[model samples]
Target: MKIFNAEKIKELDKLTIEKQQITSLDLMERAALQAFLWLVNHFQDKKTVYHIFCGDGNNGGDGLVIARLLKQNYFDVHVYIVPFNENFSIVFNSNLGRLKECNLEYEVISEATEFPNIGENHIIIDAIFGIGLTRELAGWIQKLIQKINYHQSFKVSIDVPSGLFLDKKTTIAIHSDVVLTFQFPKLAFYLPDNENFIAEIVLLPIDLDVKSIESIPSTYYYTDLNKIKKRYKPISKFSHKGTQGHALLIGGCFGKIGAMVLASQAALRSGCGLATVFVPKCGYEIMQTATPEAMVITDENYHKITNIEFNFQPKAIGIGMGIGQDDETTQAFHHFLKTIPFRW
Candidate 1:
């Protein structure tokens, strides 16, 4: 799965609409239908109520379509439109008109209106904001998200969490139990900093243009099992220890030799034919005693590493686990860097 930024995703949507010769309304309906099907499959209990919060943009259009589909399927549905702005998208107006035709219950939230009562029995569908958001949420919008999070209901976000930004650090965001994103996963969803805002993500395919996805350039990507399996090579039956590659693990002060010991052990476990560890003179007996399978080398300094010397070159080098920034150790690191052919 490829991770796309906000602009690239918007471009994908535009190119999809143009190349597929489909109206934006039809595309919104497709995304809404996919979300509805997913909800139906996951929420088997028919008695549960669904409270959908929509905005005045295309994301809100998605919520309106979902509400209509849920009503057709005989599910209890409640729709609320967050009146964040006076202007509304054409597709959103079309969906709102279609929703009103069915006589389903719906309301528009304003300054004078009270927030809806939500409980744990109700599932909250958030469509307030999507990836196009470029500013921080304020006023009642922030309070509304806080209220939604306070309800402790099972929340699902449409396309993205209501207030989360795709490219920057998120300050205020909706706490969702799951996110149903269209097309590709957003870059913010994969970052560790946004883990609290993003939960289990479901990539909802809206049938966007494949050529657009392939043609778009991105610096990030999502890896899967198939991609990882393709990178490994099977070992031959006639292979020998010397034929396999060797690995050198370098790092360790007098009191922190355990770091080097663990690194050498990991190198051996990772199928490196030969594993060697370099430490200070004080750690010589410790490394040799703890790991007899690994070859041990010690620097001339007793308490800290001053230099690294070896008769033969290893296939790969691992450094800087427990190496402290002592003056001697720093010079030794510089010397090692200058001696190695590979760039760090």
Candidate 2:
């Protein structure tokens, strides 16, 4: 799964609709259906009240469809549509027509003068804004989001948290406990700095065209089961000790031999056919005692490592494990880099 910027998402939407021949309406329906499927399967008991906050965009369209579906299931549902400009989205209007056909009650909050009283025990679905949102929240919508945050209800966002940037870090006033993003995981969701706003993220795959999506150039990636499983390979019976490559580890001083020990363990676990470790004279006993499997080489100095010498050919070199960065060590390391026919 490739991670994409906000601009690339628009290109993806265009590719899905234009090149792949998927209509915008179909995407909207499928998106709503997927969200509704989750709601039905997880919260079937109708144990909690549902309040959906919708803006005048496609995100709100999704909320309207969910509102209609939840009403059919006899779930206690309330929808608040924050109307923007003079006109609402066409798809949203279509969903509004359907919700009205079912005679479901919803409040059109056009202004902040009369705010809706929210209950803390209910679940709030934030559909006010999605990835298309660029600027900061303004006027009553900001207050509305603040009120939603203040309510302390379990909030779930569709696609993205309302007022959050899918790529860059935008200062958002609203936060969601869990954001159910569409398709790939957004970059902002993975950032440690964004953990509070995103909290926990769940990816909902909506079946975009594989070929066209691949053609779209993107460096960012969303690593998931599907992407990893597609390229996974299992070991074969014909494999042997020499089939895997040898790995060399350099770095261990008198007091910090444990660092090399941990690294060597990781190398062995990673299926290295052969492993070698270089340490100072005093740390040789420690490394040999801890890991008998590793071939050991002692440095020239007793208290610290000064030089690395080896005869056998190694496929990979793992360095800087416990290497000190003092002036002499730095010069030695620079010399080592120049001595080897390699780039550091």
Candidate 3:
């Protein structure tokens, strides 16, 4: 999966509209239909009501389409238009006009209007804002977000939360139970700081142009099993122990020698021809018993590692696991780094 920013997503949508020779309204319908189908499959009972909170942007257009489809399917639905911006997108107005044909009613919420009363049985669909939002939310919009968070209803966000900044840190954002995103997963969705705002994510493809997506440059990427599998190489049947690479792991103190044992075992299991551990004298027996396959070299110090020296060359060396920051240990580590020819 490739992670894209808000601007790239907008560009993809434009390219999709141009290359597919379809109207933006049609694309909006496609996205909404996908979301609607997911909802139907997830909630088989169809007895619960969906209270959709929409903004006056393209995201709101998607919500309007969803609400119309749900109404046509005989499910109870309510649409609340959040009047935060005076200007509306062209597709938004088009969708709003189409709502009249479905015989479904919608309410326009303002600062003075009373918030809708929701219950535990109802679900809240948040389309208040999308990836395009770049500024801090204030005024009635902020208040509305607070009210929505206060409610006990299960919250679902479309694309992203109303106040979140897709490319940077956000001061306020909607805490959704699930996020239904289009095309690709946004970078912010994977960040730990925004985990509360974006709980679980479901990626839905809206049939964007593949050529355009491949051509677009991105700094972030999501790796799956298939991508990782492609990097594996076939080992030659005639290969011997000398042909494989060797790995050395340096770490462990008096009581933390288990860390070195674990690292050495992992290196050996990873197909390395040989694994070696450099630890204090106290860790000699522990490493040997834990990992009999790995070779060990003990330092002169009895309790902690005070020197790092090896005769044979290793393909890779991994350092700093359970190595305490004592004065002698720190000095020894610095001396080792200075003595070795540093290379990644």
By TM-score, who's the top model here?
A: 1
Which lDDT tens digits does candidate 1 get at residues 1-344?
A: 68888888878988999999998998999999999999999998988799999999988899999999999888999999997767998989999999988889798886666779887779999999988888877688888888888887899999999999987899888898999999887888878889899879998999999988899888888887777789888788998767678888888997898888888888888888898888888888988988888998888888988988877788898888787889989999998889776533
Q: In candidate 2, which residue ranges exceed 4 Å CA deviation?
A: 20-22, 83-87, 110-121, 139-143, 226-244, 252-258, 280-286, 289-293, 302-306, 332-344
Q: Model 3 — TM-score against the truth? A: 0.84
- Which of 1 and 2 is ahead in TM-score? 1
RMSD of each: 2.4, 3.3, 3.5
Q: State TM-scores per candidate.
A: 0.91, 0.84, 0.84
Stretches of model 1 off by over 4 angstroms after superposition: 236-244, 342-344
Please, what are the lDDT tens digits per residue for candidate 3 over residues 15-99? 9999999999999999999899888887777687999999999999999999999999999999999966779989999999999
Model 3 CA RMSD to the hidden true structure, in angstroms: 3.5
Of 1 and 2, the candidate ahead on lDDT is 1
RMSD of 1: 2.4
Better of 1 and 3 by TM-score: 1
Distance from true location, Cα of 51 in model 3, Å = 0.5
TM-score sort, best first: 1, 3, 2
lDDT of 2 by residue, 8-78 (tens): 87677777888667777778878888888887787667766899989888899989988888888888899
